[model samples]
Target: MTDKTLRSVTIERTGAGHFTATNARGGEIRFGTSSDPDGGADFTPVELLLAAIGGCTAADVDVATGRHSEPTGFTVTVTGDKISDELGNRMTDLAVTFSVAFPDGELGDRARAILPRAVKTSHDRLCTVSRTVEIGTPVTATVADA
Candidate 1:
């Protein structure tokens, strides 16, 4: 078993403007700064950030509500404005909107009723990604060998 206190991924340069990040479990995602003849279908770092924010909460809400009933239509849209200011380059006005619908009747009613709370719980206390952004943190960067 691995330590649950820490989670990490290793990123390596595949070529110019493109890179691959691999988690400890070996899940890999390729991304690049831009889509040129070389970029392929890879996602940009900003998109990944948005995904992480939305994904973390989406997972929490899904598990919370899914226990009661499955959603007929479920989608989470995360939007933000990337700006360069005193904070340097960062996303602002972040929003995670969930468009979820459940079937008719009690099972659906139960899920629907809890959806708002589930989303609120995630935003307030559960989602690590969003929480980190909201609370803020300092990131130190250095060359490992240095």
Candidate 2:
């Protein structure tokens, strides 16, 4: 039996450094290795990774805080340094920063009060993407046999 918790996406190459990922629900996203978003208009693998990290935690934090009060503004920024070393190319010094604003009132005050704790909870355990990266999960690559 397949694991109930298993989630996956199928990636198909469309061209050099370009690909499409289709999820089980048939949602598709196009991405490429191009560094210029304005020129190529595609997200690089590293950028995708950063987006995943931020998006995951953002979802978690949103669920926790939105129930209390909707924010006037919310943003999450994920940043990292890419370096090639003896360990090969990888990201380091990763950081996630949140800029949020709530209205002036009791509900907003409550949301502001819990914002820090909500972010902490997401980073500590709620965000699977960030948690997996933090835990250094192994990735296995294989080619299909003809």
Candidate 3:
């Protein structure tokens, strides 16, 4: 097994409900909840979570199929259902649908055959975001003095 490395992002509140998350590499992503009046400018955290899953898998599939034939068209739609119980609100189910079109002829057939495997590999082992959600990764929170 490869050695495990720590990955982290720092999130800072920019406004009442808006925040900015910065990765170790200094890349930043803005996020907010629907309750925020300015939330329309950026994706909400929940939406970002869904995007992470879809984007990860899409990238993997694209690379996998590139070996056989480039896809003429590619799109992914990810949807999640939210449920509220006495405990709190959480996502109940998520669905990811991929629409891909390959070039006509034998190359297209080859790409089609590889699509399932690509998706399987991504969901089962390659996508860190989806795998973490699927396996229930533990998250610990603590507050530090400013």
lDDT against the true structure, per candidate, is: 0.93, 0.94, 0.89
For model 3, how big is the CA root-mean-square deviation?
A: 2.5
lDDT of 1: 0.93
Cα TM-score of candidate 1: 0.93
TM, every model = 0.93, 0.95, 0.88
Q: Write the per-residue lDDT of candidate 2 for residues 5-105, one digit (tens) a residue.
A: 88999999999889999999999989998896565888888999999999999999999899989999999999999999999999999999999999999
The candidate that wins on lDDT is 2
TM-score rank, highest first? 2, 1, 3
Clash number for candidate 2: 0
Give the C-alpha miss distance for residue 133 in model 3, angstroms. 0.7
- Under the 3 Å rule for N, CA and C atoms, how many clashes does model 3 have? 0
Which residue pairs of candidate 3 clash? none
**On residues 106-145, what C-alpha lDDT tens digit does candidate 3 reach at each position?**
9899999989999999999998889999999888878789
Best by TM-score: 2
Encode model 1's per-residue lDDT on 26-108: one tens digit a residue: 99999888836565778899999999999999999999999999999999999989899986988899999999999999999
